[model samples]
Target: MVFQCQRDSWARQFTTQVVSCCPAELQTEVSGKKATLQGFHVILEDTILFPEGGGQPDDRGFISDIPVLRVTRQGPDALHFVQKPLEPGSEVQLTVDWDRRFDHMQHETQLFIPGQHLITAIADQMFGFKTTSWELGRQRSTIELDTPTMTAEQVVALEQSVNKKIQERIPVVVTEFSAGDPEAETVRSRGLPDDHTGPIRTINIEGIDANMCCGTHVSNLSDLQVIKLLGTEKGKKNKTNLIFLAGNRVLKTLERCHGTEKALTSLLKCGAEEHVEAVKRLQNSMKLLHKNNLSLLRDLAVMTAQSFKSNQPFPPHRKDGDSEFMNIIANEIGTEETLMFLSTGDEKAAGLFLLAGPSAMVETMGPRVAELLEGKGAGKRDRYQGKATRMSKRAEVQALLREFTSHQSTEE
Candidate 1:
C-alpha cells in the first residue's frame, strides 16, 4: 500500500522589522505625498538608491530609527527589506546605508583598466568580449579593452598602467543616461544594455576607465587606498587570468604572512633566510648514509654464501637484521642448484624462502609447496621466493624441496 503526506504551504512565513531603507525609495508606495507607517508597508515618492543584483551585495543603512537589514529585488522593483516593518502610507524621512553602498560601487567601477580587448560575435546580437579577468576571488571582475589579445610583455605593461591609475586618485563620476540620448551612446558603443525608462548609471574615471553599472561605488579613487596585482595566468586562448587585492584585505594578508614566517623560523631553529639551505644539507647527508649501509650488507652476503654445504638446502631464519642479509645472500649464490630458506623468531614470526634449482623441479612443484605451507610465493624460470607470516620449521622446508626434486625426476 502507498501512503501520501500533505505539505504545508505557508509554514515558512516570517514577520520582520524594517530597520533601514535604500535609495530605491522613489518607487515606495505613499498616500497624499506623505510617507506613513500604518501597516507593515513602506511608500516613497522617488528614490535614487540602488538594489543588490548581478553579484553585488545589498546596501546596508538605517531607515528612520531602524537599520536596513537587506535589499531584495522583485522584478524591476528593488525591495529594501528592513529589520522592522513600517506602517503603510505614513510620512517619514528615509536614509540609506551609504558606506556599504559606496564600497560596492567603487569595486564595480574599477573594472575598466586599460589593456588588450577582444570582441566576439557570439550569436546574432549577443557579443561578449574575450578579455582578461583582473578582479578575482572576492569579486570576479573582467575588463575588455579594444584589442583582441595582449602578449606577455603587453600584459605586464597594462598591469603597470592600471596600478598607476589607481595611485593617481582619479575621481569616479557616476551619471545616468537614457537610450537615444548622447550619453547613452557611450553605453551602446560598449555593447551594454540601455535602460530607456529610467537613467542608466555610468561609472567613469577620467580618461582611464568607463562602464555602465548599477552597483554602489566610492566617490573618488583615493578611497581605494591601495591596489595590489597578485598574479596572472592564461585563461582562454586570447584571454588572461588576473588576481588582485585592494585596500583592507591586502593589509590583512600581509599581517598573516609575517606571522607564518615567525612561526617557521622558531620551529626550524634557524633564521628565515637560512631555513631552506639547512633543510637541503640535512637531506643530502641522509642519502649518503643509506648508500653506505647497502654496500656493507652486500659484502656480508658474499661471506655467508661460502658457508653453505653442497647438496643441502639452508633453513631460513630471521634475526634482528635478517631481511637485508637474506636478499644479499640470494644475490651472491646466483646458481641453479642451491635453495635458501630463512626465518626469524620474534613475538610475531616471519619467514623468507628463495629457491634456485633445476628448472624442471620448480616448474612442477613450486605452486603446490607454496599452497601446503599456507604462504604466498612465485617462481620465474628456475627460481622462486616465498614469504610466510609464521616461520616454517627447518624440516618442513627440507621435506618440501626433497619432494619437489623427487617428483620432477619421476616425471622425467
Candidate 2:
C-alpha cells in the first residue's frame, strides 16, 4: 500500500480510520539516556506520517490528541506507535511534525541526491574511483568510494564542484514506472529489492544524473543552500569514506565551531589565531614542572631512608605519594633484614602499599596486610606491592607489622 506521505510529501494532516491497535514497546532516548516507551502500534487506514525507511528516520507527530512516538513500515502497512490506543474502527486525525519532516527532506533530498550524484560522477570521471556504498546519518552522511586514499586537493575539488551545481539551480524531476516496464531498466539503480512490488520511482537531477529511490526529495538543487565536505576518512579495505553536510547542517556546524573558537580564545588568554600556539606552550611548561616535581620526590625519599633505624620494623606513612615513591624509599633503605611497610596517600581515601623484608617473612605477612587494607597484591623474592582503598587503617597495619617483627626477634 502506497502511503499518503509517499504520494504527497508536502501533506501535513490527514483524516484516517484506525485499522488495528496492539500494545507495543519502543526503545528511544530521553535527554541522553536510553528509555523504553510503552505504546500501542496503531495501523491507520491512511496516514500523513512517513515511516522509517531508506536510511531516513521515522516521522514524529500526533494521532488526534495522543502523541505518536514513532512510525515504522511492516511490509505494506505503515504502523503508527502511539502512547494511547484508539478504537480499531474509530476515525482519527493524523498530524505530521512539519519542522522535523522538512529538515529530514532537506537532508535527504538536498544532501543525498546531489551529494551521491556529484561525488560519484567526479570520482569516476577524474579519479577512476567507483561508488562502493553510502550512509545517511542524522548529523552527517558519508559516501564510500572504492579507493585506497583521497588527497586534500581532490576533496577541495569535489566540494567546489558540488557547490557549483547547487548554484546552477538545476530542476529535480521525479518519474515513476511500472515494475516490469522496459523503461525501468534505463534508470540507474543498485537493484530492486526482492519484495519490491510497487511502481519503480526515479529521481532525475535535470541533465546531471538519474537514480531510483523511494524517499521524498526537493524539487530543485537550489533548495540545498550549500554543501560542505567535511573531508574523508579511511574505510574498509580499499575504500575512502567522504563525509559531508548540506543545507542547514552546514550553518549549524559553523555556528558550533565559532562558539568553540570563542571559548578557546577566552580560556587560552589569546586571540583565535594564536590559540594553537598558546596551548602548545602551556603543555611544554606542564611537562617541565612534572619533571622537576619527580626529582624532588626522589631526593626526599633518599633523606628519609638514611634516618631509618636498622634491624627494626619501620612503617612509614605519608599524606600524598604513589607506588613509585614508596619503592624509592624502600630501595634506599636496603631491605636485607629490616622489615619495612611503606604507604602514601590520604587516610580517608585510597593509597599505595609496599612491604619489603626477608623473602619468607614478606610471603607470610603480605596476605595479612593486603586483607586489612582491603587490597590485593603479589610479590616475588622480598617485596610485595599493590594499591589499597582503606588507607584509613594505617594504624592497624603498623600494629600488625610491629607484632610480627617482635615475635620473630624473640624466637631468634
Winning model by lDDT: 2
Q: Global lDDT of each model? A: 0.51, 0.81
The window of 10 residues in a row where model 1 has the poorest summed lDDT is: 1-10
TM for every model, in the order presented, reads 0.47, 0.87
Which segments of candidate 1 are over 4 A away from where they belong? 1-50, 59-70, 81-106, 112-136, 139-156, 188-196, 275-412
lDDT of 2 by residue, 1-412 (tens): 5678777778999998999999999998999999998989999888889888766678989999889888988877888888887899999988989877866776676433323465566566677777777777777888888888999999898788878888999887878888789988987777866666667887778767787776767778788888888999999997899898888888888999999999998899899989889999999999999999889888887777876754334636777677778788888887788788988887767888899988999999998899899988888889998878998887898899889999999999
Q: Can you write out model 1's per-residue Cα lDDT over 136-247, one digit (the tens) per residue?
A: 2453344433334445565555456555666777777766666557866654233543322455556666654466555555666666666555555556555555555566
Q: How accurate is candidate 1 locally (lDDT)?
A: 0.51
- TM-score between candidate 1 and the true structure: 0.47
